[model samples]
Target: MTSCFNEMYLQGAVRPPYARLEGWTRAMPAELRQMKQAEAEALFRRIGITFAVYGEGGDPDRLIPFDMFPRVFSHAEWTRLERGIKQRAQALNAFLVDVYGRGEIVRAGRIPARLVYQNAAYEKSVVGFVPPKGVYSHIVGVDLVRTGPDEFFVLEDNCRTPSGVSYMLENREIMMRMFPDLFRENRILPIDSYSERLRRTLASVAPAKCDREPTVVILTPGHFNSAYYEHSFLADLMGVELVEGQDLFVEGEYVYMRTTEGPRRVDVIYRRLDDAYLDPLCFRPDSMLGVAGLMDVYRSGGVSICSAPGAGVADDKAVYTYVPEMIRFYLGEEPILNNVPTWQCGRDDECRYVLEHLAELVVKEVHGSGGYGMLVGPKSSAAEVEMFRARIKANPGNYIAQPTLALSTTPTFVADGIAPRHVDLRPYCLVGESIDLVPGGLTRVALTDGSLVVNSSQGGGVKDTWVLAE
Candidate 1:
């Protein structure tokens, strides 16, 4: 494998963005570092900031490992990233509105009709209805990976309810508490307004029927869900009610939350549940996690759903290959950020190439997330490679392949001392009245030696990301 780019050091010298951190890491003794690490863990545990990993034994509510070292970005670097992210978000929303309404991009042959109309995530029920502000995906989480100083590629786009913003906020909070001097020394941008920004974004899309201050509620599956803590945490931060299906009901023309002081009208719903489990009467009759007839109210402009139902189709892995085309067709502009070159297994030629090079490429399921159902070919054994090969051959349309990228590395604190670890970033972009994102994002680091995956569910840890102010 080729040597990856080191974000902190270049040509044996500390990079400008990370220069200040060099002395800070060098000054801390091993004993003091260990003590601070323990304190951070204790604080996370005491605050109930834990996540559940499905199908895992022993302690389902596991605390995700938190690394003390932070990932830093220069102001100029962040500016470029921010522009690209916002552009992508706008194009995605435009595509969603067009596909559900007129299918302009599809008609123009910029993207395949089958990829859009026949997608499993495409909701036929939402066919001609446009959400308020024409924004189907209110929040967009674009996963990015860096390979060189000026080379960055989008790994994937999360148009549905994206988890990990809680981690972003918590990581910063803990870092500020543990190293107050770092904040005093550096002009790092503040991300404390993220919750308020999110709240305002949700409220901005209130349906036309709402005349008063729109009531926004976060609709969660339940406490047993893996991201339950995040659901509750966001609710607390935004000062909104976090409710389940049982706590809400659809009345004559609107949905209402059952409160102690009678049922309160809800105008905007920031749902954390999947589309199928959002409305039993519309998608799945057996789904008890959603309110019945809620889709009716949503479609009738009585209420609004952030990331409207059908938004997932825009982020489908197979359809992802056409996002750049969507940008050109919808926004008439070139994509600011490039997508990692992807080969769809659904195509016969691509399938043959992937089969022949199973040991040299990464294969992933079209709908998989949390780093599951993926094969990192460079790090896998022969048996694992053959297994994935067989699976891809059996069902080609269920997968896509990409070359194993030499993901960039950042300074990380390990048991021995400071070292470099592969890392990725997921910045949350909000799209409502306007598209915007905070300066920093959640930086997931691969904790295992020579590993590339950085998902919390896959034993990877997180670090606070910093963007220095100009």
Candidate 2:
């Protein structure tokens, strides 16, 4: 029978309808599937994976868009990846602290000092201040793509307010109903502890200068951010106050957040706003979305910011290629996960080589994300290639090129029934007293046929990842 996979793990219920689940089986057994559908909706409601729409001010709850099927990962696979990611984050954290504190790497000429000062994300305000526990990046979401059997590569690192763990939590709940039999029968690693882990991680670095239990706040950029659901979700899960930029103020040496009860001291802030928008006084004076003088208070050690400002430099596309070396240099260990083959445009030789092979490489803007400013080599038109060639020639360092990779595919339900689609996983990790990784991650699928762009902004849908027992 043609099921998604061998259904021997399914208990009680009949094996998944692998063969018969074609055209007629969809609607004819709608009610039977309705049981699964109803259960999912009910679970979602109970879990409250809701988004707060702007117009609806009072009971602002909107259901997160979710799918029934979950992508599964083996425990052994997760163990290896978990170790790799933790080590990678640790190294990056050390790099950020050193970059701003002593400029060791920059002085050593590993990373250009001009690049640091000129980066759109770099914050000069955080130069002298050290973060609590010396942890600059507490939460990190590392994106990974499978190119072939047991071969995975790092797509990017989401260090500044990396989101999507809530979706991971909610997705697990949905999967339980969609495949109740499998969930009950198979051994699935529970991801329910993610929120708690996040709380501990945030709490761990609470203004080490303070003696009391620190109040952690989830700083959001208001509601327009695409990951607003995640911001609110994490806030609710962590039982922390969710504050927008305007809801905060910096007074003298400390930062305070507005609440029904006047102003309350904020010991730690898990800010989701980009570094440029965290403090207008420090970075961009014209920015209305940032708190004035917020960075001053943070630098004074009155409050801790998760992933202290300027952490983005480590995630720079060019710096990504050097992560393995950084891992070895800092951690004295080999990276368990692999990096995708990347061609650095900053290198004169690599730029010439990339230009010659324009039609076969995936050219990308180093600074952009969410699938913006990217050109798939095999899919680009002649005009596009010519435009990129000129753009790269003028500013080679602004771009990076990688060979087109055939990312692994998973079967997903679509208009044409179940079919294989390219997918990638981004797992959220919390670094504190210890490392905690959510068992499942956000599984993004490229909806268009043969389309490699998988950002949600580029019409990608998310699936709940399910790590099944061996």
Candidate 3:
């Protein structure tokens, strides 16, 4: 009915990649489906895989719905995505290294100076320092949306310690557990190597002072943070210790993790905490979530941060529009992927256009995440649009606007039957000595019949993403 591409269907014919699923979806019984859904929920509950949603009434910790249907991508399609992801990661890191150390891109006038140096996410503490291996965002989660058969646009880039890989891995694990026969029948590429790849990427970015095999640890903001489960999950998968700020201390010039075997010198940290709470001495003096002088040790090259501090500057939504330019400027190549045509509300003309078309645009805060501080104009009421217009007028620089994308849909199971729901893909590209990722990624689905939001915080669900073998 909609113009958006139905990934599973085209002109009443099943797409080649999804041909085998035609019978699978048809043959699966509703009674068995209901039972399996309950079983999956129990499996997730038993595994303790849940996320915390802030500013919500009642129980904040909730399980993200998991769709039994797997999202499939062909090997060729995945290959294109993999290349684009790596290219984008390399360009963004190069931009970070340049922005922190030099003003080359700014001098070239490729991107506005205020967008970087004046941005809240930019850290003055890391202005002249570069992380080991010149990697700013060690893990890049590039969010992609499809509108047509061959048209995939990158919605945005997650440069600073992107989460949800745990979901990607867990989705596959649960799928195998729930439907082993399906996996056996399909020649899906394996994503089990992600944790091992992550471990290697962390170790590969060890500081110059680390002479021995790097002792990598995941630094979490205790058990109360939203992504605490992912922090512990990745740590467990990587066979590393998960420590809080209290467990890590800076001594002399190096960071040491408190262990049962006494203080173990930490060479690398896969930090899940934010930059503001990373070091109380350097950023927020009143913060209790960070080490006293960890930044000092980090700047002194004692240990490496997986995503170096100040990496969020590159992740800013205002700076996102210049990513293709960053690719051309830094990588000396055109962007392999396309960015959705975005309107920076900071610009007078763009702001005017966005204000005039508030009813049809999707406006989001430049620094907002987790599906908060966003307006989906088409789905919003007139009152909501008016409220958003006033908010944008008051602080135009805080927002960016883009046309509502006709996000592609896939066959998803529901209480009634199989239906089409909007979905998005977040491919995690690990950057360190080299850029690599498992073929599949976290395929987030807006489970509601006509919704477009795919963030779990907005009532979205996860599905196993299967990148079929060649």
lDDT of 1 by residue, 268-378 (tens): 999999999999889889999999999999999999998899999989999889888888887889988999999999999999999998888999999999999999998
**lDDT for each residue of candidate 2 in 142-180, tens digit (9 for 90 to 100):** 999876546778888877776667777777766765666
Candidate 3 structure quality by residue, lDDT tens digits, 258-301: 98999999999999988999998898898888888999899999
Which clashing pairs does model 2 show? 2-18, 2-19, 3-18
Error at 53, model 1, angstroms:
1.4
CA shift at 222, candidate 2, in angstroms? 1.0
lDDT against the true structure, per candidate, is 0.93, 0.75, 0.92
| Residue pair clashes in candidate 3 | none
Q: List candidate 2 segments past 4 Å from native.
A: 1-65, 107-118
lDDT of 2: 0.75
Q: Runs in model 1 with CA error above 4 Å? A: none
Give the range of the ten consecutive residues with the poorest summed lDDT in model 3.
Answer: 52-61
How high is each candidate's TM-score? 0.99, 0.86, 0.99
From the highest TM-score down, the ranking of the candidates is 1, 3, 2
Could you tell me the TM-score of candidate 2?
0.86
